[model samples]
Target: MNLMFVHDVRSETYNEETFARSYGYKIWEERYLPVFNKINVCFRNKDTNVDLNGISDKSSGPKVFFDKRIGMFKGPDVFFSRRIKNILRENIRNNDAVIVRLDSFLGLQTISECRKINKPYMIELVGCAWDSFWNHGFLGKILAPYLFLKTKIEVKRAPFVVYVTREFLQKRYPTKGISTNISNVKISKQKESDLNGRIEKISRLGNKIILGTAANVDVKYKGQKFVIEALGRLKKQGYTQFEYQILGPGDQRYLLDMARKFGVENQIKLLGSYPHEKVFEWMRNELDVYIQPSLQEGLPRAVIEAMSLGVPCIGSDVAGIPELLDKKWVFSRKKDKANEISKLLKKISKEELKVQAIRNFKTAEEYDYNFLLDKRFKILEKYKDFIRREK
Candidate 1:
């Protein structure tokens, strides 16, 4: 059986010969390949102005393909082009199932066509559509409420739904269909998470405190901006004992400008995005604190992994973030997140940091890669059974 996976995550071409993805297709292939004979990863291409310089993955085998032969313009532009319509239509008609990663424009279009053609379909809700659009700057602000409602309506009618968050997304976009919650994060048993070493890092806090997060520098919603603002706030309060680092790929010009305004430009470092395998090593050896300052999120895998590595962490309390954090560590509002993050920095102590390190590692223990993969497979198996019956 062939599975069609439709999501709005845009793709970029580095050399024009192949497409690269920041999030990569390898993770999706790993999840779906076991359940189907083949999987078609149908994603959008980037807009003309924005580019992230993405890395490529060598995941395609005899069983799967990146079928972008479905021409460009994945929007109302589809109405103007016959070529775009036919390729998309054939992919839908030939595939045994369509998995729409919801609340995205491309996913909406894919689902609309699936319903019209009476094809078997399923939903995988990853994050809040409302937050995604609302935090997405000007164009997104205007579309936020409308998109949120549109996504909510479709989710309610979906026949099978999988949520990355257990509570937050379900409350916002409830589905009447058979449903399950399985986070996309996958940490493994073989990897070492040094809780004792983390305790020692906190012990060495007599020196400068190093705070780090993983997010693209240019993306405002990733919430690194607030961390910069908070760093500035701390500087004003005469706490120069701090260094902030971001590990993700993007143009850092805006961030540098923001840091300069706060007079803390020298304290911030931008480490370009690293391969997933190498980043954990960085996290384990380098970080004193891991902060997920996202304006919105599903269960953030970075925070969970930081926890697994016994890194003391804090985040803006949005989406599934609160589910993973203690109430005391979470900041409730975006407008006040800078102030909130500043407050947490002010009060951080050796005892509290060690306690959190131990606590977070214990909680993150449940997310080992093999354990979550089994849960994901169970729901997919149920979905495959549904597809067989539909035929």
Candidate 2:
């Protein structure tokens, strides 16, 4: 059967080649392509000027619908455009099944169209748009309630649901029909092996701990500010041996400025983006502590990856973090997380850290792609059976 996936992540251009090269394609190739006879993706195309050079020029397997213009939320021109409506209507009619990545306007419209046409569809609740609204700024606060309410209603309509985080998202977006927890992150055998050696080294580390976190600095909600504050507090307390590393791609001006203000500039380093392989190498070999102080998350992949490498993790007690971290490692986001995190740093013993690292590795094993695939396959099978019975 033909499968259609709808999301709001804008692409540079609309071409089969670019679609094939995108991260979305990798996900579809791994998870859905095997099950469906053919796969199609519908998303916004940002090539408003029609730059042919910007468009991908290679061959691709899955069909793509990049008819929608970018900036749906910026104004009404694209939001109320007939082009988007026709695109969704046409895709819904052509596809045998639809999977809407929820909380985005595009996903909402696609699911609504699917319902109108009596099409079978499911929801992939990857992130909380409401929580995002709360964290990002004034705009997010304004849109959070509407998106949250809309998603709650749309979720009930979906015949099946796939939640990225088992506990966090499931609690917020409850579904009436079949549902399963399938995380998006996966680790390979090589990665596991790389982690094994690094685990022993980190397990034997001394008083000089190396703390690290990987996240885009552009995401204000990541709580890098809190981390820098915690480091400053630690420094003031004479805990000066540890070093902090922040990874991922983005302008570091804000973070750098904040670090300097806190007088912990020398304590932290902003390491830019690296290949996944390199990231794992550093997580496995170079880091002692992993911090994910995000104000919100939907089962953070970076935290899980660090845990999979046998690195002890500390994060905000929000979303799926508690499911991964013990209470001692989690701090309240609303409170002075800096003070709480500093206490954990000062109080946690080396032996305790080692034990936690071992425990983390075990927890991460449960999220391995192979394990998640089995659960996902079962859900898909159930959906297929449900569809067959309907006929």
Candidate 3:
């Protein structure tokens, strides 16, 4: 078998690469390559191009191509281009199976071409892009119809669809057949010896580390502002020992200014962005509690990683988060900052926190790479037969 995984979206590669580090991408590339014999990944370098310098090991088994000039034409006009259609038609001709990661108009376009060419193709839905745009007030009300029409057409035409969450399926296409989110790899348990140095570094800072949230500050929907406000309230109530760390890239000057306005500047630390591995290390040893205040998400890897490390998480009650927690562990008043922060503080305890952390680690076992990969391969096997019958 020959498999080609097409990623039209560029931004996800950065975080995906970091998350896959615990489970080597080369190992994953090898597993899929031999199962199919030949595997190719077609993607576009929209922003910063991916450096293929160290990817040479798996480069031969699974060829990766980054087209620099693709997606030059923005908006709906992109779908009508002959150049994109021709390029996709050529790629689909040689590969026995193609997996299209949802992020670009090309994924839907390729699905249409695959249907015409009698090629086996699968659609992977990370989330509804339109929903994200709408939630942020980025997409105008005038464009709602256009977005809805496009989504409906794509869902109806695609042979198979993979959703990251049940919420995604219910909101986007209720009747569509759904496959659970599949992780290409997994993270191994970090040994205590490996974290000793980091633990010492954090211990040097003092004993009172309270809460931490890691994400790009510029993304308003991530809800760092809400956490900041919550922390300010906690400080006003005489919770002086706690420190809140916001880690990621983007302008933190305004956030810092906001902290000053709230008189909690001393308690808030804007760590900016660090290397992914370093951040993961910090999450394991430096942080006391992990919180993801995002207003929306599609099975965020940060929360999953924290859970895997036995870090108890307090996330906004939205999307797939409750599913991840199995409705057992969650911040009840997540929409109300002050109440949520109060609840979090009340829940923290030496013995109770440790017990909850163990539960968090145990919950993450179901999402392990081996388990998800097995589920995915089984789906693909059945899907292959389904497509054959259709042919």
lDDT top scorer: 1
Regions more than 4 Å wrong, model 3:
11-31, 37-62, 71-77, 80-86, 116-118, 140-149, 166-172, 175-185, 189-207, 249-263, 272-276, 326-334, 337-339, 384-391
| Residue runs of model 2 more than 4 Å from their true location after superposition | 13-25, 44-79, 189-196, 203-207, 385-391
Kindly give the number of clashing pairs for every candidate. 1, 0, 0
TM-score of each: 0.91, 0.86, 0.75
Candidate number that wins on TM-score, 1 or 3: 1
Best by TM-score: 1
Model 1 lDDT per residue over 1-391, tens place: 8888887665544334324433444575678877888888777653334333333332334566666565356344544566655767778988888899876676777777888977868998887888887998888888788788888988999888999887899988999988998887867773343887888778877868889998778888998888899999998889888899898867989998998988898999988777676678878988888999888677888888888889888888889988887777888664588888899999988899999988888888777788778888898898889888888
TM-score of 1: 0.91
Cα RMSD of all models vs. native, in order, equals 2.9, 4.0, 5.3
Error of 1 at 101 (Å): 1.0
Off by over 4 Å in 1: 13-26, 46-62, 70-85, 190-193
Tens-digit per-residue lDDT, 337-365, candidate 2: 88878888887677787788778888888
For model 3 the TM-score comes to 0.75
Residue range 16-86, candidate 3, lDDT tens digits = 23211222345436345434556655554333255422321112223434333454455455578888778
